[model samples]
Target: MIKNIIILFIAFLSVTDLFSQEKPFWNDIQKFKESDRFNPPVQKAIVFIGSSSFAMWHDVQDYFPGYTIINRSFGGSTLPDVTGYLNDIVFPYHPKQVVIYCGDNDLANSDTITANEVLQRFKLLFQKIRKQLPSISIVYVSIKPSPSRKHLMTKAAQANIMIQKYLKTQKNTSFVDVYHKMLNKNGSIRSDIFLQDELHMNAKGYAIWKQAILPYLKK
Candidate 1:
């Protein structure tokens, strides 16, 4: 009986490990929850949700003074990841506005994924948000022209255009176009704005974002 029980326990451990591994960024979400439990977030603040771009912006609050900001971004995340974690990252905050910076990783993640798919995923997220918080403002930061992901620029542009068009018909929705602004006069991506990795941004890139996004924030 002891040997049988030990075997069952080992099997249970294996299953638990597998389940945790299956959930991408689970630890990140858990950490957010833990932080919220102790510190508590400011209700009705502007919440930023998405991938590494927003996550890397550790100083996002400093960029906009007098605006309450709650950033729940997890690095290396895709659109679906954000959608999957909406309960944790978004709704609970009862936010006044939501600023998103995603869909970049969705395209870069797989060749099989298309721009239209990115738009669809975004719509799903939008629909869910509207269903739960009907009156809240929504802002989408257009996927940046990352120097490292230059090959995927066409796909990114297509996704951006479609998302921008879709948001036009929705009330209280603003699409901030940072993609074109990040490009040079010759229409090339500005390499100076990116970090050494060419994937993430440095201060200059965030500065551009601050300008583009500031006007849309709720006072």
Candidate 2:
């Protein structure tokens, strides 16, 4: 009986460890908070919140020069990680609009999350933001179709469609479809618009993003 109980306890611990590993973002939040660039003094700012795409885009302020813009991105992060630190990075500033581009990392890292799960997390995040700052507009940038992550395009499209549909029913939420703009005639990512790695955007890519967002910025 003693040996059987010991084996069952070890099995329980193994299951717990597996579950913990599945939530990869849980371990990265502290590092994200420490390295976050958008510190404060961000009253009425247009904050860009997301993973490496936002972090690596070096010309965001120049692209949207009129508004008080803040880039609160950390590379190698996902929506779960952003959700963990939303209050500190997002709500304290009371932003006028939040432009988000997350979930690529979640798709890349996690094996079990379905398109539905990704959409559910987005809905949860929107609710959290609404509760904290009721009047703020939440703008979700559609996950760009990357040549490197082409296999995950179907999942990405499904997630984007769900989010766009949900945003239609909300008061201050909008979906920015950069995915459609980034595609070439063959429905693949435009190689000319991306870096050599085919994962990140080049200067031309940022220009396209800027043009899409120009109309929305307040004078």
TM-score leader: 1
In order of appearance, the predictions have TM-scores of 0.92, 0.81
Model 1 weakest 10-residue run by lDDT: 13-22
lDDT, each prediction: 0.95, 0.81
For model 1, residues 1-219, the per-residue Cα lDDT tens digits are 999999999999899778768999988998899999999998999999999999999999999999999999999999899999999999999999999999999999899999999999999999999999999999999999988999999999999999999999999999999999999999999999999999999999999999999999999
Expressed as tens digits, the lDDT of each residue in 1-219 for candidate 2 is 999999999999898778658865544444445555454354788878889889898678887766778787778887877887787668767888888888887787877788888888888888888888888888888888888888888888998998899999999777888888999888877888889888899999989888887676654
Lowest summed lDDT over 10 consecutive residues: which window, candidate 2? 24-33
Relative to the unseen true structure, what is the C-alpha lDDT of residue 65 in candidate 1, on a scale of 0 to 100? 96
Question: Which portions of model 2 miss their true places by more than 4 Å?
Answer: 1-40
List of clashing residue pairs for candidate 1? none
